[model samples]
Target: MKPSLQLKLSQHLALTPQLQQSIRLLQLSTLELEQELEKYLQENPLLERMEEEYAPPLPGTNDTDSDTAEASVNETDTATSSADDESWLGDEEDSNYQSASSSGSFDDDDGDYQDVQVATTSLREHLTAQLGLMSIPDRDRTLVQCLIEALDDDGYLTQSLEDLAETLPAELEIEPEELQIALNHLQCFEPTGVGARNVAECLALQLETQPADDTQALALNIVRNNLDLLANRDFVKLKKLIECDDEQLRLAQSLIRSLNPRPGSKYAALDARYITPDVVVRKLRGQWTVNVNSDAFPRLRINSLYAQILSKQRGSGLAGQLQEARWLIKNVQQRFDTILRVAQSIVDRQRQFFDHGEVAMRPLVLREIADLLGLHESTISRVTTQKYMATPRGIFELKYFFGSHVATETGGACSATAIRALLKQLIGSEEQKRPLSDS
Candidate 1:
């Protein structure tokens, strides 16, 4: 065996530190981006947020002379920063600040933000409060409280009496029969079906409390024995089994439908998620336009005084920090630019959906946008993940516009979302006596 060395010329992609940071900032959601900016502002002495009064004019100035001068100064600064190892300070002078404001304006009439307080009660708390008021003996009350704690969020007692009995303390010396009795008493609590073991049992428990009548008795019998038939909506079979006419069966069904399946859910704690959209879309003149939400982003800039002081010093670490701060500013601008471009492309492609509704939404894929905007599919995915747009209809996540394609009768394709919308409309307007089938 022999080893030989030869020179070969090839190229492979490598991401620089600044480039990696740019990519990371590009994909962060609005809330995450704000937090990242805050961290940088605290850690980096060169970076500071621009006040409202000091905000510079927007980018892309129409002044040709100013643009040329700015370009020359930038080039000179770049060369000096690269070549001078002893001192970053140079004889050349240039404007110290760059504009950080985005291209569009926000509506000043949107009103002030207010904090809202929400009051909520959990299912367990509601049950315990009711249990505390019972006049029963302390021992039986203890057993009932055990069963109450065992009930799930949906008010269904999923654990069997045997299982619960085995888990009881040996000192209590409780039996399965006593636990069953406690469960029965617990079932009698308000929100009628709290301790039921299953759907049939829950419905039967509610039905038993209804006033005695022929219809009530028949409904109870159907729920207790033929709950499966009722769920399948086999009216002909149900009519035969229950010995009732169409009118009576319909009335019974209406009664059954009025019963609550999840009685304890009303008492569950409220989990409200607040969404702040990254883009606001509206009709301008005769065409639709997009604007990045200024309120969601912090206005950041380099400190001019620090930069001036650092320029006069020789061989200081502040130069690297200054470069990092500039990179951060440029990266932030690029992030918003990419987002705005992507948002415009979406609005253009989904004009029909905006004009009509979800039924008019077209079939879209990440590749389509990626190819249109010269971006990677993974980049498109990241951009759409947690970003949202506010439209005239409602606010929707960017991912909501892209869906699988379904073939139509005319050999054209429809989005699965549109198909779902159509199906929902059909079901909603269907006649109860003759419901529409899949065909």
Candidate 2:
């Protein structure tokens, strides 16, 4: 190979600082944007929020109704502001649940302790606690604990006894029969279905504890073998299988319905997330209209003092900060503007969805909205990623309106969402004695 230097002309797009910021702000969800803004507010002294001030009612508005609503909101804002000033983590509602003050004195008139949220006991912990008091050999207790650890969130043993025995130390000589005994002891523990191998066994374990009767026996047989038939709501097959009348099958099914299918799920940890819709949709004059949610973003502005000082002192160090602040405010506004544009485009395309239900949803895609709005497909993708819109039907992610299409008998197409809605409607409306078939 010859040692040579070659130069080729190439052209590429360069992202300017402002364009980068715009892209970043557009991609962030409403919650993330707020957090990012909080970071900028802390770092830049030249940027500040324009706190909303209460405006007097317009001349002809209902004074009493508006005033009362305004007063309550103001009171809540005042209390929240004070609490935040004291401590950022403090809540205004903490006073109700707080039992003692800083001086260690009770706040309540009665001496009863204020109830606070207690930590949840996981499935393993609950079973182990019950195992502690049992009068059994340590080896048996250890085996029971091992089996308890194997139970899943739904309290079913997904692994077979042979499989589990294989996983144990070979030198210990653990047998499937021994494991079965340990499982029996475990089933005797509270939450009767804790060690069940399947749904049928779980229901059977619970039913075994109840006094045996005609209904109990029939329910047991159904759960043990015909659970699938009952789940499909095939009352006709159920009557023929159980060889009983409608009243008898009805009572047996009622008994089975009262049993919990997932016993350990109650111990699972719960996580609650709150979502703020980015836009709201409403039907106005027989047409769906989209409006950006004002509360989703903060009203921001440059600090007036810093701006005036910078204006007078052109060479001040705050010039860069001022420019950054202006960019932040503009980019945030543009972000919401982009969201409103995309949401309105979606609602316009899927207008039938708003008029009827999900069954009326027409096929749509990002390309359509992108071409219609003269924006890139990637830009529309970012806009609909996590942004939510509130409509009369329910709050839905903006992306929900766009889905894969299914060809219809007519030349047009229908959305997969619409197809699913149709299926659900058909299944729901089918007769209970004879449910709809897949064909």
Candidate 3:
């Protein structure tokens, strides 16, 4: 074949970094946004709070002189107003953002450390707790720790016993029999599927622990040899191989679906990071109103004290400090402006969904919104990724509004989300004995 170059016009999805960030921000829960905000504040120090309220002076003066004085006072007030004031352009609440300072810290007095606990004990911890129950010598316990560390998030051992044993010194040799005993003990932990060598073993461990029956036996057999058939429901061949009829095969299929595929994952893969809902939409008088969560966001003001010091200082120090201060203020303002624009766009696109239900979700793609806002798709994606809005329907990720378009049979496009809503409704009304299989 000869190589030739030709230009063709077509559309394709390109995931840019800004688009990725928007998508990520759109999906972030309330807790995550706070954490991000905290990080920004730590890096930038020009942002400070205006704690003192403004009070007007007494009204009394000669006409021309008083007017000039009043005008000057008004300009000063405009320049140094609180964040709650209209002139203040920074985000509604910068302090609400999660930061190391906001998060709990070590108490030297109590000799204790405290941090926001994002997740409960992981799968490894659960396995180690089980090890505590067994009467193992310190050497074997150390080996067990190494083995536990080798297990993947799914609780399958990715390392061989020899590999784990080799990590220890030459004198502290681990026998296969002792290693086998430790492995056996580790397999019996809660969540049923921990410490298996592979997926087949994982399923088998669960099956062995469950109530015994022919269905269980056949399902185990299916897991062992004919696991590939599980994907497309090729039960005819499965029936032939397992020597079971149609009804028996159906029962086995049902049993297998109910099994936990990632047994260790339940304990291990809970959200490592939490999110903070950015925009809160509450229904009032049958209409939705959007507000930023401001519980912890205190008003920020240019520190008059710092500004006075800068003004008095004569050297290069003042110039550097002034530059730093201006940058800090500008960044904070930019962060808020971006957040507000993104939040408003979300409200505009998802208005119908918020008012009605999931069925009313629009066919909004990140590219469409990014084009409208004159921003890179990746930027929009990051902004939307982990951000959320609380609607009358329920709290939803901002990214939830932007779904891939599915062509309709008649003419116009439909959102993939709308189809999923239909599917969910159909399934809810379906009979258990005969499922509503996809066409």
Candidate 4:
């Protein structure tokens, strides 16, 4: 142990602070990166966020652009207030706007945003609104309203009329026939298929409103009895059973396709997810291009007003903070640059997917991209994970482009995505009698 000084050689791995910061920034999502920058801005006196600048619309733009410019001017006009008034962000108004723009109303004045109120209505409410317009007797109206309440979100009264009659108070002496008559009235509501107990009746109710032609009669009979034949797309069986020709069967099929299977789903309050894409891709002049979304990351700069004072006053003990600020700025730039390179490489390899669709996607792996970019597989994973790319098709994550390979019949390989796409196409087009199996 005492002779340890004797010549010995060894190697040890170490990560510099700058390298650690770069890796951390690379792995962060757009929202996480924005939050991280906000934290740094608050802590570092030398760092500040630059204000966003919106330029005027170019001349000779489309009418849509002109409308948007006018709307922007209107927004500015409506939002502006005198200096003595409350600031735009601090509006104390209790007015309520709608969560959706077209649903409800509220005033947006003095340049301040108002809290929006949720204005969703359930199936029951929608039916009740129409029921209020009826001039039926109070007794009949009550029974119809009860049936309306029984209807589910898809506009189907799930319970049978017999079950509904028995569920009513025995002292009221209600009968299943009365409930049936009330249901008939409910079925004739604005949504033609509402209040039906089953899919067959739902479709039949809708077909009842169409022109009373031979085609409508055939369609009505098929929905009420041979609905399964239609679902299986058995046109030959339908033609044989209904004693109809090919054109009549085709017309009936088209009529069936136009029916709403879930009539009340339009009123369902669907939750929407928002995503901020890190990169945007577009085909420019017959060439695919990848560019960083500048708005995805906050613009940061060194505070010249503060840095100037620090420079003149020597030994202010802020040199470490100043160095840290510079490191953050450089690391942020490197993050976007790495993301752009990786995204561009992915788009180049999957260009077929952009032109055609998922079926044309080629097999890809992280190792292949890492080797091409001369970086580690871990770095590629970091660049792909949680980072999204906006393309003409839709917004997709960077990792969505890479997948495992599936062996093909030509002694080659296909991407799993392409295989799945092909399987889906086959399944959709497969004949009912001879459907695809695991084999």
**For model 2, what is the C-alpha lDDT against the true structure?**
0.78
Q: Which stretches of candidate 1 lie over 4 Å from their true place?
A: 1-3, 56-272, 432-434
Q: Which ten residues in a row have the lowest lDDT in candidate 1?
A: 64-73
Error of 4 at 251 (Å): 35
TM-score of each: 0.56, 0.60, 0.55, 0.52
Q: Is candidate 1 or candidate 3 better by TM-score?
A: 1
lDDT of 1 at 186: 93
Please list the C-alpha lDDT of all candidates, in the order they appear. 0.75, 0.78, 0.62, 0.77
Q: Taking the candidates one at a time, how many backbone clashes does each contain?
A: 0, 0, 47, 1
| Most lDDT-accurate candidate | 2
Candidate order by TM-score, decreasing, is 2, 1, 3, 4
Q: What is the Cα-based lDDT of residue 375 in candidate 1?
A: 96
Q: Write the per-residue lDDT of candidate 4 for residues 3-95, one digit (tens) a residue.
A: 555677999979999999999999998868888898999999999877656322222222231211000112212321121121221222112
Name the 10 consecutive residues with the lowest summed lDDT in model 4.
67-76
Best of the two (3, 4) by lDDT = 4
Instruction: Go through the candidates in order and give the C-alpha RMSD of each one to the true structure.
Output: 19.1, 11.7, 16.8, 16.0
TM-score of 3: 0.55
Off by over 4 Å in 2: 1-47, 53-205, 208-218, 242-248, 264-275, 283-287, 303-330, 355-359, 374-379, 392-394, 416-439
Segments in model 3 whose C-alpha atoms lie over 4 Å from true places: 1-150, 157-199, 205-219, 226-275, 282-289, 296-298, 316-322, 429-439
Sort by lDDT, top down from the best = 2, 4, 1, 3
